[model samples]
Target: MTKNTTINYREKIEHSHVYDVAKITPLEFQPNLSARINNRVLLKREDMQPVFSFKLRGAYNKMASLPTDTLKRGVIAASAGNHAQGVAMSAQKLGCRAVIVMPTTTPLIKINAVKARGAEVILFGDSYSDAYVKALELEKSEQLTFVHPYDDPDVIAGQGTIALEILNAHPEPIEAIFCCVGGGGLLAGIAAYVKAVRPEIKIIGVEAKDAEAMTESLKQGKRVMLDQVGLFADGAAVKQVGEHTFALSQQYVDEMIVVDNDAICAAIKDVFEDTRSILEPAGALATAGLKEYAKRNNLSGKTLVGIASGANMNFDRLRFIAERAEVGEKREAVLAVTIPEKPGAFKTFCRLLGDRNITEFNYRYSDPKEAHIFVGVAIADPNESANLVADLIAQGLPALDLTDNEVAKLHLRHLVGGHAPQAENEVVFRFEFPEKPGALMKFLDTMGHDWNISLFHYRNHGADFGRVLVGMQVPPNEQTEFAEFLQNLGYPHWDETHNPAYKLFLG
Candidate 1:
């Protein structure tokens, strides 16, 4: 029945009323990034859109194109992030009753934003896929029109308008256009217009390394579903590429690249440094791919365009971004070094570093024989971290690079050395300390050093609270006392004695 359902995506895009809620965002040249990569890197600022994302274009177009009868009955969509805002804003514009189903874990900011736009927010399961199933059920029971975030021709056409504006402003040829692919609607839409209008322009799709459903689908020549997707880039954390979007992308996209969270965080910093705007993890993914592509090909003096997709980041998440950005950009190297506990041991270690700026330093004077120091040093480039590690190892310092260790990055960074075998009845627990002065002192005083601190780690995240991992040694007979101690301590803690990473690294 629907051999021609795909229709002319390009024709629909050309006639789209995306400008109703969207705008022709600026295509700003990124001189700093361009100079660093030795390419004419430009950012298509879709982040400047009213809803702070290109999602509005598709959401508005889909709602606007609906028959008058359907519009009267209202629309429904499932999204935990940008798409929810898009539909809410679109619904407000069209004066329709919009229902947005979001995951239970969705941030309060997003939930409230949708509510502010007059959409009824229903918290469903823990992911977009779960919310999608619930939304489909509601569409039938409530008789609401399901407005898909990606997949649909109207949505794809709305997103495709980005390509039209990009080419219109810069009639000159672009070597490659990098885009982030979640459900594949944005990438598919842009690919349609670019492939049709400027067939020579390369359309490269980027995906989070941990969430590469679209990449896998493109490689296998069919749609592929991942059992699970990472939530770091929550906006692009789609488990499977849309069927229609995947089919269209296979024809239009030239290549695909997958980058890790570090690169995405680094790219976020890059955009912030250049445009003075911080983007969500998914928002900076396209630029991350662009930088990676330029480095891999060693291409210079070429024009590379990246869609800076959105800036709807929660302010608190910036702390995590800043922490990882250095490693992602290869600007900092984190290391765990065991130096002799003698008088000149620390001095000699500092001498070895020789003029390198110490970005961070956390040391615990535990053993009289040797001390362990968690250090982060400024680096010149991507390879410098490895080079520095090699230099330390060659110098007979038992050094281990903790740059890529998940446990080290999250917990161990502040944690003191592993389990103390000598201490009886050792217990390891993770805690969150209120981020105010004297909080640490309050704990120490409350615990009273009577228990003998076996391990402790804490780092400030520039927020209202700090995360800590602690290991305390207590005698078996003192178990009752320890329980009473914890209740009296009044600070929350989680036991991590059996964590695999702990056993591997510290046990």
Candidate 2:
């Protein structure tokens, strides 16, 4: 945290035989992704480690560096999941007792895994910040050594070992290496070692769109605490980057990239298709960044590497990932269209489709002459939706692309109903707000608690932004005032009261 001093981490990385607890994972080239991107898309298979993550390298290195007396006193650390497993397994190997304090929100599978590694597990509070407090208390009470996840010099050096293996396995010059940043330990270590040895290659950090602690810190030249961070990628959901890691990242990293949850889900599917492996959301973050980076830079025939950081995925979460992956990849399209409500009208519209596949269709009669329908169609390519929209318009069928519309995707897509007949002076809207803890309270405070909410729907996708559909009862006389209020609200909102899809369903 103090002015960072120059460290010879490249020298340490050269000597680190992470093979003590970690393995020299394969650096495999993804043929399918490479062909698609027109680049040599290489995957650093850190997910193949015995612990299913890269955490063990740092954890073992730090613990192994501890003096004999400190090992006898044991060590304590706070972690939600992956780091806890790393510390526990490392302690076991060194014949040292490890105490892990974890948030109650951690998945049971991860908690059990840490316990299986012979660590005493303590489930404390709701988040990492809370559990961290408890770990500090225990460290003081038991006179134990505290393993700082990403802040310690030895820990960062251990993680730097990854860069050594990467360059060794990949002889070809790389355009860049993409890494995901949570507390920034992995990015910090990799950037340090890589920058020292290969100053020409770019060391880019990837962060979740909402959980961009390091990105903001680097922007402002100081650490910033996020009010809340998305939990979909639980392993990388740190509210703030470690001070040491931030300083290191600022010194060595070339640039940072932010990706959304949908892109991450799509990347998970991409890795599965390429290597028959399912990656956790955080694990696939680097892959998502690589794809976005390659497209943005328009670089072809160049080599790029993405670290598959971990595979600690829960089985039940697959359903949600699968459902959103299509939207993330733009392989599926959603639309709201107006069609005549008469016999043979639906048939006539179908004929204009020209063999495109339909994924979902929801329709209800809204008027005597015309009907509004919400439709989902599969596209052969990511950019095909715009062309299809043009095709539908050319056929005299009024259509609107709802694929990127937040309200349509989250609420209206799943809802189907007639008009709210008894509701008076109702104005319906869809809003996207930050997904942190107090986001809804701030929105309601901004809107004034005096208004009545007639309709509300929210589904959590573990992403940075929370999508909500709300119907507020407002008098016609206050229309102009409401518009002004909306303009100042600062959240991305759409007036859905006049939307044909809303008229057909839950108007």
Candidate 3:
């Protein structure tokens, strides 16, 4: 309805049956993070709730206040993940039936969670909006009551209870509150309650840059539907903010901050280091906002509370998280080095590395005439990276650092050794064995130091074969040394170091 109308509804939510909801979630102070940020940090551990998110607070509060006869008709909601679990768990707790329509792409863990909560989970759609469309169809067909995720007045009010708990727990003056904004329901509710009680306390909404629906909407003074959203932060990957939530956000929200994926990844790592809790990208939004704000304003000695929203991360996504965390924190760098392909050339390059541990090293001979090799190294610090480049230059080696380059990280890292000079005498061998129990030692024993590996590329591909693309530095004098070595190895072999394509890529 109207902006003021939602505030009125929020007041009604205070008088509704919300006592049970508040009893379940209470604000807890995080002294460690507070000390680091030079402010008092309190976490509302909504992730520890029954549904592993704060969504249950609004869902339960809304469903509990509905008329008994309406509840008997059953409820329907569309969500691919957290919201589905929240609605299912809340309905089960209230002795009501919930039919959840989720996207087919939703993880099995989430789908099974909804079904385990006694909700009928219908997998239909490729995204949340698609599921929402299907949910509306089901509501019409089954005569079920629809529970809007964030737009409804009751849901907003239920989320407002979070503000009440925070104030009650920390009676001391709070300077600012950082909360993640998805459809803007959480921000809308908390902003209304906190601003009403202590008008001076600033309410800041944090959103992922990839899914900045509310921030873009507020800037345009109307809802703007995003064409596509990044699904990494699934909890907040909403295309548009709810009408009611958007209105309240416009009225009470003081500032909106958008953070990139890398910042969120860094924040996730920060939370884990401080609290030992694994937060999904969306869950780390508020903390990311706080860090960004602090860095921007040079703020210190202000009481800041960041809501650690939820922890429902997909297990399979952890690898991506780990890979991105270093870049996010500016702790890792990727470099490409060109070195003279000669005897002891690699040894000289290795000496120049100078205490910087190599996270990754790859090299291949591209051209026999040029005799240059391409190598990738991962460094520890961004500041040290520049120093490393200078060191390589002084040592007469040329290097191109691509640590900040996105394309290099995604594609170039994997497509490294394809191009090199095809040596008719070069031997290409595929070692078949698990990456365990001295497999490399066995392969090395077969050669007995007779052959020097000119080009070596080994990546553990989670397969039976540990493919080693080896090019022995066979002098014109020792061409037969490699042939004998390959015959004794007893593995599939092919010579590709002399391939024309190999020359282009590796050179």
Q: After best superposition, candidate 2 residue 282: deviation in angstroms?
A: 0.6
lDDT of 3 by residue, 419-450 (tens): 53544344434344323456677678977865
Query: Higher-lDDT candidate among 1 and 3?
Result: 1
lDDT scores in order: 0.85, 0.85, 0.75
* Each model's total of backbone clashes: 1, 0, 12
**Clashing residue pairs, backbone N/CA/C < 3 A, model 1:** 414-457
lDDT of 1 at 136: 100
The TM-score-based order of candidates, best leading, equals: 2, 1, 3
lDDT tens digits, residue span 1-507, model 2: 345566667787776646678988999999988898899999999999888999889888889888999999999999977788899999999899999998765667788999999999998875688899999999999999999888877788888888888999886799999998899989988998888888899999999987999999999999999866766787788888987898888889999999988889889998998999999999999999999999899999999999999998888778679877888877898888778888987987778766888888887675798878888888877678889888889988988888876567668877754557778888998777655567788777777635688898887654445568889998988887788778767766778888756665676
Candidate 1 error regions (>4 Å): 1-6, 422-505
Candidate 3: lDDT of 70? Answer: 90
Q: What TM value does model 2 have? A: 0.86
Per-residue CA lDDT of model 1 for 45-131, tens digit only, reads 999999899999999999999999999999999998789999999999999999999877576778898899899999887557789
